[model samples]
Target: MDRLSNLPNHILSDILSFVPFKEAAKTSTLSKHWHHQWQSTRNLDFNHLYFANRDSNGDVQLQPQIFIDFVQQFIANNNSPIMDKLSLTFSQPGDFQETVEKCITFSVDRKVKHLKLDFSDPTWDENDLDGLAHPMFDLPQSFYNHQVLESVTLFSCKFDVFGFKNFGLLKSISLGWIELKVSTVKALLANCACLESLSVKSCWDMDSLSVCGKDLKLSSLVVEKCHFLDPSFEIEAPNLNYMKYCGTVVLFTVNGTSLEEADLDFGPEFECDESLGDSLYQSLNGICPTRALTVCTYMLQVIPMGEEPTGMEPRLNVTHLTLRTAMHNYEQGGIRFFLNSCPRLETLTIDIDRSRRICNEYRPPFEDKFEDLWRSSAIIFRCITQTLRKVEIKGFKGTPNEVYVMLYLVNHARVMEKLTVITSSEESNNRGPETFRSIAEQVYGFRKGSENLAIEIV
Candidate 1:
């Protein structure tokens, strides 16, 4: 009786799912029954780590003969075409252009349903930066043409030639640290009519990225740290469920009328001609009006700067609100101006650094008359019509001004539920644990609320 043969089919398949396709294929030599078992494995992971070395400088060098022989042997040994998940990470220097191309060809030929390529092989030095671009790999014109490609990830690969049209059954594509033309991006979206999720990270030179599909069902879209594309990339997908953009600024118009969630990162200097801030707010209201919103922006002066926000109709309700503020001058006017826009906000998280004085700290007889100015700022303005449930204050340092703002929230918010004060080690605390404890006790000393506010000092 063969020891490996005793393992259940599902258990063997699960084991094969983790091992590299080449290794899985080699396991066939264990027995005649195992010969076809490896070929029947649905997951393939072609990694070069088993055949690579690092030099003194930590640069990776791969054994070409070992890798090449593994690929050839695996391809020839695995008689049946049963590849499902494929992950190939080449960590060596110098081009395995031909070898890489052959691996992709083999996967395509075998109808590999999922493909992930991380080409960190330092060997790709363009003969000339402007050399006529060609795709590093090619597939059969009808390759995987009708086969379902569930998930695909391409990192640092040339996508100038073949794209989504070659795989109409693609559900998700993650382009990480990739540089491709606008046309290539468009081609992928157009070809993959049923694509549900697309994530692009650190890809440069694509600002005006556009997506158009007829029966498109994009659920999640995340673009992070990619730069230099026209801000107004037209996205015409109706079923977009979640969208997140971080570290990159866009000045483009989005047409996702059915968008449910959005996380946009913007700063002060980011100027939008069409008023991106206003457009975003309005667009959110138009779709998922009551959805939670998390926006981070640096303070530009006593005035929170950006495009002068276009007035919005008070129709939407915000569930979660976070503000990372920068104060150029310690005037309460900036915070007031910023908070004035978020009327229906229920939960508030603030990280503030302000030099402005709080009014309660004012002394009599004109000695500290400057405190009156801080009191009269927009913060104390009686303008909130909605109920605020919770406020979390991170990096809360015991400043008279900071305490004043905290007091204002405590007083004004009609239905304040809880206020959590988290202080970092960097914040100067002369009394250490005693100081934080005393500060926590004194936070709500000047203000009143739901009587359940909790302050955690860390």
Candidate 2:
């Protein structure tokens, strides 16, 4: 008389997909029919969070060995010949690394398509004084030889991938907070001919890294927060569609046939070789046909000042352009040339500094009370903003300089349909309602080209 005993096995398996592996196995207590049904489940999703809250006294360590044993025994008794995915994230120093190696071997034996291993402790921050714990598990050589692995993600592990011979179907790979030799990364990428997405974040200890192959089919690449000793790279991805680099710019060469979006962040006191900007400008030359572009204020500062973009043409087809500036520097105003470069931009967004940037609080603020605020050389060609239909200003404080910026956009963007003004919580708390009223008065009286233009402030 079980409520779900009559459901077909396919329907039960579909329902089990919504629950974690351990929870799904609990159905065995419902009736004798379910005793062996969970064994045939195709996914081995063992997450520590599923059983983590039951910990005694909220200890940072994993909840208990019962949950661990349940998952291990379940996988040990698995009968499925082919698993769709095998994701295990038990980020504590519980089992030996050999146990994880066996689990991966088990997945490979069953022809698992997607595999994820997150052994890194979630609470272990590298910046903490005594943060080292749960040593990075070393991946077995056989883990890299599995041709059925279409996607693989490894966290907090050291991979000696230099010996890998084949990554036949691997389309995506993400490694975070891991350690690896420079030669190992090079060999791994050289073997992954079909790699489409690559993400490497917060990894350390490298002098130089190079990834280059004429037949490489990478489409999306992200390199974030990897503070290397001598950060350098040489990447040639001819088919990359999306790329985001959020760290110190390395000396690298990345070229692609076509790119749809590119986000570059060089804030947070990150820097690169003097030649980085120049080389990046050349790499961008390959993807000048990009539709969406985002750059932080630090990179914007560097490109205008140092990078020799003398002969480079502007990316006119960019439909969306986002600029990240420091909260305080939003008023000092130096991004006019960057805007003009994107001629066909349909949306213009101004964001606060990407990460926690050390703001210079000692300098006195500047106030400019001008009717015609924008005086940059780029403003002479106000006709370039014909396609700019929407404008959003985030972290807007009612500083006099910010008022000037608002006035410029209100004056220039003749056909703009909507303009949104969003203030940071701190600004809303500190500044009274009069500050907003003052800015609203100017916008109310500003002569907009479209009579239907709507300006909303928050």
Candidate 3:
């Protein structure tokens, strides 16, 4: 008995929607009733790389024409009147420009709510010199006239902001590897009246950016690795709740009172300067109201230099704090600064970022010993004694610094409830079971402040 085949057509179509279109198409062979169900799927995701055949050397042999033909056939056969999402990822648009235009037109005509087009060449390294020379696909004029688009993601595509129209319904947009002028970005934001989220990464031809609008509904913004972007970044979105920035230290004037979370990674220590320290201070002060904060090793190194000579009082309202570092001795001052500042912090997370170990060589030599740094500190953080409940150490290797810090937290956080140590994949592979058992025994032997504290090693 084929009970699944006996199900209602709409139910079968809904079920098929959960499977990839390629796999869903295979269900046609199951029964005559299932033959047309796939055609009614609301979401269409086609990746040309997935269709490409591999050669003897395992190199991808792109079949652009074959992929084009398959997509054309699918669109022709599909009977769905409306689409929830349409994602097309392919390269070499010069080989089939018309087909690509037609696909965009089809999605717009079907009133797709979500559209993602990634034209990044899979064979090229985007960071390489030659890769920067790769041409970008120009979006068709029809792409600008959509009235139902709610979300859009574009990668390695070139298009003018002047072509934009009727984006009243658009809510989210993500752009990567695109050359956009600051004015062009401003114009795009002006057009997206209802936009709630925007992400820009690796964009070029922009030295400065300002995201300011009184009625702007944007709630989240992400900017990363725009090498040309200078230090003058200004944001004034009162509705913004989340922001993630990764790049060189920037002079930021963030005025979002609603900001709740921020992840800041100011790249290598080589980029840091005394003036940049003030900029970092200003940036951190602007987002002081953030309830949850995440910062990298670069920020840790710069914070001490940025602090006032008289020393500012604990001002951050952060309840949850995450530090990404190499746990080097130079970072001790920064770590202490954060512990003192985040008075209300309830959850603490330390992520060992191995890539930041290179920063040690560039940083000025510190006379403080790693083991003695914490043990010598007499300052009592209010969070450790009263508020902190959980602590997590990721990329743990059971090193002396890690063990000392773990013991310090275990012995100090009187109200703490749990401590979790997640061993790094590299450490787990290199160390034997006996080594782990020894580490566990050491953790268990620590004199905990809270008798009910639960400890876990994974």
Candidate 4:
């Protein structure tokens, strides 16, 4: 007779979807009408950590046997044959291998479309200097051959790739901290003909990385921080529109097909190679005719070595370029080189936000040499006089150098309409509201090339 229980099946299922399965199953005790409603739910999500109640001392206290029994019983009682999504996360899998396998089988049998499995160890330090290791759970071979599967994600697990079969609708795949063979990676990628995006990060146990999607719809690729893999890495996606790489300094061959945007982050620890300049130039050439580019400060070191301005073929046709910098004086030379090479550039953004990037990548505390103007581009380039319209400087802290750049653009950019030097939430608090007024007065007081130019400081 409860008003909540009187709701219709569609409405009840919608409400229950927000809650865990254990809580949803409790509705059966409320009324006869709600008894079997939980059995027909389509989205199945289970987490061992949730059921494994903690003790007074903050340790994981739930019994493994109890979790296994509950999971096995829950799947057996559910009647839905077509699951839209299934996600399972287990804190520890050594003692519960059968439990993990059974849950996967249950979802696979019901034609699950989207699947995600994570086996992060509960006891391990989340931020341990060393990263995650392989988990004990073994995914069933049937998971790879499922015709109805569309997207798959696996984390911190080991699997044999030799059994992978064709997936008709698989469009997206994301793997991290996993172990597999080089041949297996190639075969799996080749099999997913309809795949549109693939991401692999922090994984190990491979000699060479070769991804071939010649006759497929693969368009976006991102691979990052796979330290153990061999130096040799290759990709054959002609239609790739976006790429982001953060690791070693190997030359990536793109088969002459350009990207709309490329974000390259050779990690902070990357040591400069003898061919650093050549590798950097080749990558830009491969993704030439690009509209946008975001490069880390470390990778920009070789730009001033004469590998640019002429070595670049077709030159970069970038309209929007984002340069992540350490705000170091040395990196400014490289930034100037890029501006000269990309003649079509219309908008330039300089970001000094190092909190989100790797450690040691960005030099701390704004430098004091800004009062001297260092060696900035004083010659208002042709792009600034003709095409440059907007300029944004993120993480603005009223540093003298940052203010100088703002004033430079305001005075030189003939066609620039608006210039923004915005501060993040944390930065805004650190720099009180008075800082904005000072910044605005400093730039707006100058006689700009364009009368319509507007300057913003926040």
Candidate 5:
């Protein structure tokens, strides 16, 4: 029956390309026809964990020598002239560092386009206050000057930024769990002329970051959890369309008017003070041109505390907005502030934070009625009557406050076409079918502003 093995060589090579390198190598044991087929694969991914041996008691025993021998054997057998990608992930190279350097040289000589090298130690405690030293893996100089590389990802590695050569064709770069200086980062960015995406996460030793280039083609940027980074951050790329930042509050000076989406999260541990609120307000104002936006609970609580700029309306151009909150009483003011600022908002989504729901015992509940709090003034928001079309409420628990807010939106949003209520898993598990049926009936009986309104509950 082995009819699949009878296919032409090119067809077999194409099929093997879709399989992982380890699994593809297993095909060689199936039949003689497949012995040489896997050698033609254009992509190679070697991970130390994949080749780990287990003891009789089922404890993992890392065999660096075995992994090294297997890779060397593959390189000896592989005859491919060009490689699309080469990835190597290992935790402890120990005395085999020279072999790791040789592997990088081999991939570079073959003109691999995408490269990923991860040497992170999985057992290292990321949250340890004492800060244990990270495993060090230095990249060879051969990887710096490659003209054919289009994307590169490095984790827990060190390399001389001054040794960087012309990376004219590079389009993406990601660096995580590493130590980098401001000058090194700037030098790297200056050399990669064609880069479109850049991600830097969990890095340290930099006090400030400033990415400013007029002719740069970068369209996406992400910076997260760089603990040593100072409060000052800056960006001026004109073509940037997407950005994501997660950390403590910082002074942001963004100048990208082409931004289409942005996600900002001040970590859950953030506490708002007047100065921090002002800094957050400045950051938000700078990114107001974004079309779609996502914000966290801490941001909602702090935004209302910051003062608006002089002579500025404090309006945002966002059409779609997503809020991540614990549904605490403090977040109500922030929600109202966003509703008033986004005049043309079309879609609204509220995702309740489940992890913080039970732990928010210190925060007090809303003493005023939900309807009265939301509709205290006669000034009607423009989006409620003319712009908003769809609303989604996730993690619905059928609490009194939740019900009041739902009814208020049903009565106010005239142009709304659809309302979706997604109940939490806990609510469904604790309630019976009769309770759900009663809820559905109550929702159906509510007065809707739009005659064509459609409701869904799940």
Candidate 6:
């Protein structure tokens, strides 16, 4: 019987596509027929540089000639069909213009379906900028010839204004620290009619134009730290379902048939400005007019903290709620405003970071001057009686003020089933076991009748 381990060449080559090139190369010693089967494999993955030289921190530098020789030899030696995917990394400090061009050429020639490159050198200097000017390494006509190329990932690479004019069938793209002109970005998106998922991060120099396309069928779009994108830019895609935006006030317009979830983390550009919030509110209204929206905002220093919740309407039925407040600014009325606004809120998570000030001291009583302070301190969740179930408190200290907040939750919330207190043991911000024990004891003292309630301290 033929050994299963020694499968036919076609089957063996198919399996080799999943493993790294180096590991597949080791199989050559098994038999004469298996000697060059690795070269014919359809996928080439080069992640062994770090694995091979873990102890050497100086640098795992690979000469341009070494890479050129390997690719040329692999293509020449292969007698079977061309490769389907090519992923490579060259983090060396020296100029690799020739090597980079050759790699791109091989992908075009082999009809690679997926190409990923991590060519960024964090330690690179002005000397390395010379390579960007080389014609061979720049965007070429061959890139547009690879009709089967479905996805591409580029890091710290320069592209022409029309770099994506050829990728008409492209489905997904991820770019990091790459510079592209405003018109180039718009034209590229317009060209990728089938592009579904796009991620752009830390591209500081990108243009400020809004993105829009007609035949675009994107489902997930994530933009982080791409501050150059327009704040009012509207993306018109009916098929998009999930989106996440952070570090910018950019608004997203969802015209899709089904949008299940969306997360927005908007911070003001100016330290004391509320304009970003107003812009975000207006942008969201334009995108999801009739749909229910779950909103959570991180209080940035520049954006004046909202005393009352914004964008509250009975038309948008918000279900899940979370409020993360600065330790010192967490007043009782802030909690009240949230409970009153989100009437349909089902689950609420309140995270309080109290590493700075501890408000356990009590002032002398009998003064009418402390009315506002008392009302603010009494800002707890006694009003939220229905629909609220879970309460989680992070960085909980055993202070009277914090304990009062917990007690208020237990006393008021009718459907609460879980109350968790998570504390750290680090000296600077550690909340000792004594604090936990006190909070747990107080919870049990008040919740003796409620068997469904659970209080865990970790």
Which candidate ranks first by TM-score, i.e. highest?
A: 3
Error of 1 at 179 (Å): 4.2
Clashing pairs in 4: none
| Candidate number with greatest lDDT | 3
Q: Which ten residues in a row have the lowest lDDT in candidate 1?
A: 357-366
Candidate 5 or 4, higher TM-score? 5
Residue pair clashes in candidate 2: none
Error of 5 at 40 (Å): 4.7
Instruction: Locate the minimum summed-lDDT window of 10 residues in model 6.
Output: 357-366
For residues 234-293, what per-residue lDDT tens digits would candidate 1 score against the true structure?
A: 667778767776653444455644765566554423443334444554434443443555
lDDT of candidate 5 over 132-232, digit per residue (tens)? 68767878787786779999989898887665556668899898778767787788778788889999887777678788888888899998877654777
Worst 10 residues of 4 by lDDT: 357-366
Each prediction's RMSD over C-alphas, in Å, is 8.5, 5.6, 3.1, 5.1, 4.1, 7.5
Candidates sorted by lDDT, best first: 3, 5, 4, 2, 1, 6
Better of 1 and 5 by TM-score: 5
Compute each candidate's TM-score over C-alphas.
0.63, 0.74, 0.89, 0.78, 0.83, 0.65
Candidate 3 stretches with Cα past 4 Å from truth are 1-5, 20-39, 53-59, 123-131, 268-275, 305-314, 376-379, 425-429, 432-441
The reply for model 5, stretches above 4 Å from the true place, is 1-7, 19-40, 51-66, 125-130, 307-313, 356-380, 393-405, 420-445, 456-458
Q: Please provide, for model 4 over 1-458, each residue's C-alpha lDDT reduced to its tens digit, 9 standing for 90 to 100.
A: 47877778778777877777678778789768878888666777777766777688987775667767877888877776577878887767777777788788877788988888877555654223155554546676755657788888887766665444556788888887666567767777766678888888766665767766657577888878765456655666677788888776656666534468888887533455335666677766665666888888765555444344222456678899898875656455566667767778788998875443333333422243443443244555667788899888887666656666666677778888988877644445467546655665576677788888877777
Cα lDDT tens digits for candidate 2, 339-400: 65666778888885334353242221224223233634244334235777898888666665
lDDT of 3 by residue, 36-108 (tens): 6777788898889867898999988999888899889888777678889899998877888999999999998
Writing each residue's lDDT as its tens digit, candidate 6 over 1-458 gives: 55745688678778888877778888789777777777767888754253333246766554545655665566556555577888876554146555556667778888888988766654544223324422112444555677688998876666654557677778988876566456766766777878888877655545564555656687877766554644545566667666666555665555543554555555323232345535554555555532233333333221223322322343234465555543343334334444655566666666665442222322222132323433343543333566667777776665665666666677667777788877644333365666556655667766422347777777
Q: CA lDDT of each candidate?
A: 0.59, 0.67, 0.79, 0.69, 0.77, 0.58
Q: Which stretches of candidate 4 lie over 4 Å from their true place?
A: 1-8, 11-81, 120-136, 160-162, 256-258, 272-278, 305-314, 355-377, 427-446, 454-458
- Count of clashes, each model: 10, 0, 0, 0, 0, 4
